[model samples]
Target: MRLFGTPTSLKRMVPRGLLGRSLLILVVPLVVLQVVTSVVFYERHWDTVMRRLASGLAGDIAATLSLLHRYPDPDGQAWVTDFAQEHFELQLDFKAGEVLPNDEHFRDALSEELNDSQNENMEDVLAQSLSERLHRPVMVDMAIFARDIDIYVQRSDGILHITAPRKRLFSSTTYIFVLWMAGTAMLLFGIATIFMSNQVRSIRRLAVSADGFGKGRDLPPIKVEGAREVRQAAQAFNLMRERIQRQVAQRTEMLAGVSHDLRTPLTRMKLQLAMMGDSPDACDLSEDVAEMERMVEGYLAFARGEGTESASDVDLVEVLETVVARFQRDERCAVELIGLYTASGERRQAPTTVRRDSIERCLSNLIGNACRYGQRVRVHYIAQEDEESCSIVVEDNGPGIPPVLREDVFRPFFRADSSRNSQTGGTGLGLTIARDAARVHGGDILLDDSQEMGGLRVTLHLPL
Candidate 1:
């Protein structure tokens, strides 16, 4: 029910980048101005100039014919020709006792289609003026001469032929005007492109810096450049990044203090329990102390996962193999290490820049959970080089998480009834910590049902 398909479709047709749209904004008006100027010049200035030049030439030829009629003698005719030639720059020739040809014969013999619209218009104007003044047949042949025009005028006794310089009827200013207009437009457009690109470059650098920071990659402060608004934005971004970093540092310090304060009492209680006799109550209290220690460890690990670890180029395959081998050594669960493969079925190593410790911890948490819940664990590495990303799929052959509760399990300290039960003995922060680490590297962890393994499929996707 819309003339255009939709607003979204129209938006797709427009340039998505700022540089391209800015150039478009600059070019559209310039082209419209040029077109309007050219049209005005052609319709008013060009037409008026050609008409006046043709009329002037026609008046001179008319005067020559009148002088010839009055004298009639060859001596007087030669004199009139000399006078007209000296004054009007028209070369005249008179053929006595020769009849002018009919319109059909004249067109067949001398008429030609002129390529230039200006020349054609000039020919029409000159031919009209000559016919009106002489009241006789006039044939204008513009193509007969390269630098001159041949005009045939019917006289009382014969046909009069007049050859006039083509420059007299044509103005060179039109070409000069068009050339200057086009050249000026091109030069201005080039200058605009250069200036716009420089402005856009500042914005581009700001964007890259922001993205790197978001991905947990360390980058220097963005240099404020370009227009006032862009520089303001860059300054604001730098301030925001500093504020976030300060807040994170403060949080980490507070957590460190809290861990020390809690662990001291827990350690003292453990010492007391060990010193006491092996009573059931003492054993329960010890187990409770151990669980508290694990909860504290989990909290500290979550905080440390987002620590100030600079990114470096590391082989993802090697890290994945190492984690799989460590789990394989446990021998409690079946761990299968699948080599990295591209979509083309070729094995290749994935080398990407990421925080090595964060990525290793994320992988360890995922594998450890799989081993705890499932009997068989399969780690499949898929490298998508073209997309600049790689995916590590950790699948298990245990009672898979229900699709409805899959997302809930990722919440901190949240557990599902079926698989993430208390008997499994988890602090319920494993998936939360793993996902946080993945996101810090500009990646994500997705949970779904494993079709092949008939259990949970945890895919950790990271950008290269």
Candidate 2:
């Protein structure tokens, strides 16, 4: 249910990406299982094997020393060394005047990176194994040599120095075990990634279709495929879309019926007024009928909406220019474009998809309202660096709408007073239509005081 993240602490620790989070989901337990198995291996398998081997070696050394001590002659020492080498596979030597040192060196049999921790733990394991069996203190040096370790023990006469391969202490098979575990984790992660990617793709497609629907654009039907939950969601989306289509069709039909019924009566009223033309009473009635007709048309326009137009890429720069040009021909107040040109050069045009005529109508309504109420109008485009959206602001210098009534002005046929109404000559549907059009494109129209114009500024924002 949480989109951006889960619980706050986990949200921060985990990566903010789909694949990264999925891998973390897979890898955390894999690492846990590997750690558990490794601990078991060291405690049960590795320790048991090393202890048995070290015990045998320690017994052989004790026996050989006993034989040499019992004889004590040069010939007896020579015969003990030769016989031990041939029979017990022991490489033993005596240093007549030397003694075993107090200090001992430690290192891992395998990796150097693990030396610090492995060296201490392994040295303890080896020393304990030797002492428990042989009942003698042994100096274990695993670091001084590359592939072998030196064992030194002092007797009353001299030091017995023995060299042994480090493999006797630890098996190489552990490395193979680690490699296999790592390979299996990666394979699981890869399989999870493939499935997750497919599921994510389906969700993204559903989101795109929903966005397009909100923006009043018709998109192809989305395919329902993925897990059971995703398929159910897609099915619900299809049903909702169908319901909306049916409602739109019914509304369109009703509007057509209403237009036909109302216009037939108006046509007759107009014809009757024309036959009684020129008389003062008749002229007044004609004016009233014309005003009524205008009101009816405004209502119909607002009801009809932007019509069956599809969205397309529109150049807002050109739209603003054309609207200004049309106002100029009508001899309205001079309107200038700001931010469209800069001292460095012409600004880059930001492209956005919109219903062309819908935006045009919205702009024209705002511009006309501005020109009627104000002497000067300033239009500008604002495109921020991130480029998520663009803004078209039309500012005019005139008596601005009161802050309280600004919102009220957008209501259908809600004129503030006679002075404002007579001057603008509107049914008060202009702002309503403009705002509705903007909203359909996932944009909005906002009215505020223009700092430069000291009047109303109507800003229209459309997504890019």
Candidate 3:
């Protein structure tokens, strides 16, 4: 079940791997936190600080205006400027019989880099505070200076212009706050990346080991690391591997011992039959001994086919060609080779890594069964490189097994030929051994009715 986005398209937009999803989980929340913090500061803290500073600056301007109005003489204006500079730390310039033009011009091109909604909000608060304090319309430009602010206040006869540092209405603490927040978030994300990469690396190694084991290949040892659960899973997989190997070994040994033990009595019986060779009873006993030997050999072969061989790169087309060439040598039945295919329905020239001996044994068994039962057999091979899957299909124009007994054909010693005819020469174990071989390579063989041949169609599917 998916717990993230509801829609399938939305889920597709999400990353498929653990590390990508984990990074998304980390970064999205950090981005939201940063955005929320910025909004709160602009809405509450930034506006409050700007309003207080503007009010203080407004009082300073009012005092300067009062001094300028009280002393209208030139000498008095000069004295007022000196007093204001000493008290307010503002550079004030006064001109009589002159006025700052009421142009009311404003620079509207805000810096896209530094200007945002919060910056505009602070500008509005400062403008409102100064307009109330001065009791007249005033134009204040903040962007004209990076470290200072300019104030234009009109006097009765002229204009009073003051240039003050930006500290009067803006806060430097804002820069420090944002810088620290970004630095902290980056450090956290860096740590998360390192941790997630380590965790994912462990999982990747585990997957490689599991895949190798499935393909009947020898895998390098897996070192348990990462989270506790991952380590536990690795340990469990290792334990399961040990149990499977032990079971295979036990079965192989038991089958070998049983076959050896039974062969001794059979060898004695064959010797006894040789003594009475001329009689019909001796000939019938010899036939029984031969059939018993065949059954024993079939059982042992089936028991030993748990893929003791390692997987290797083999050209599937070459493998099919070799199998077809072998069957072509036999004159009893006509074996035809259909085309080999890839997932794109194109001919493939690349080698597929697989258990060559096991796959060959599987193909030979299936084809052998097909030719043994049918007068004509066909082999078709398909490899889907992109999907990492391959299939070998064998069909025959023989009398197909009844549909009800199709699945039962794979059971040991359960032959469709219940009469056990010498012509068939089967111990009812060929398909079982073929299936075992296919499964050892992480593949399977299935039986179905052939629509074209009106007979049996066997498909072998393997994942690369």
Question: TM-score: which candidate is best?
Answer: 1
Give the candidate order by descending lDDT. Answer: 1, 2, 3
Note the Cα lDDT for every prediction shown.
Answer: 0.86, 0.78, 0.78
Cα deviation at 403, candidate 3, in Å, is 4.5
Clashing pairs in 2: none
| TM-score versus the correct structure, for each prediction | 0.82, 0.80, 0.78
Worst 10 residues of 2 by lDDT: 107-116
lDDT of 2: 0.78
Task: List, residue by residue over 1-464, the lDDT tens digit for candidate 2.
Answer: 77666788666888886657777877788889989999888767776776667666667767887888887888988899888878766678788778655442532222222222434465555655555555655666767456876777667778788776666666667778888888987898789888888987888788888888878787767899988988898889888888876787777778889899988998898899899868998899888888888888889888877556788987877877888788877665888777876568876576777788988899899888888899898888887667788888999998888778877887888786732455767898989999988898889988898998798889998887
At residue 131, give the lDDT of candidate 3.
Answer: 66
Cα deviation in Å at residue 352, candidate 3? 4.5
**Model 3: CA > 4 A from native:** 1-6, 23-32, 74-120, 141-169, 265-286, 340-347, 350-353, 385-387, 401-404, 416-425
Show how many residue pairs clash in every candidate, following the order shown: 0, 0, 0
| Models, CA RMSD each | 4.5, 5.5, 5.5
lDDT of 1 by residue, 341-420 (tens): 55588767778888888888999999999888899999988867485888999999878788888888888888656655
Per residue, candidate 3 scores C-alpha lDDT tens digits across 1-464 of 65665788688988999999999999999999999998888788877777788788878877887887789788998898888778887788655566555453532222112233554654555556666666765556667547767666665666566877777776788888889999999999999999999999999889888877877777756888889999998998888878877787787778778888989999999999999867988898899999899888888787777546677888878887888899999999999887665457877553677878777777888999889878999988775657577788999988777777777878887865532222486788888888887777778988898999877899998775
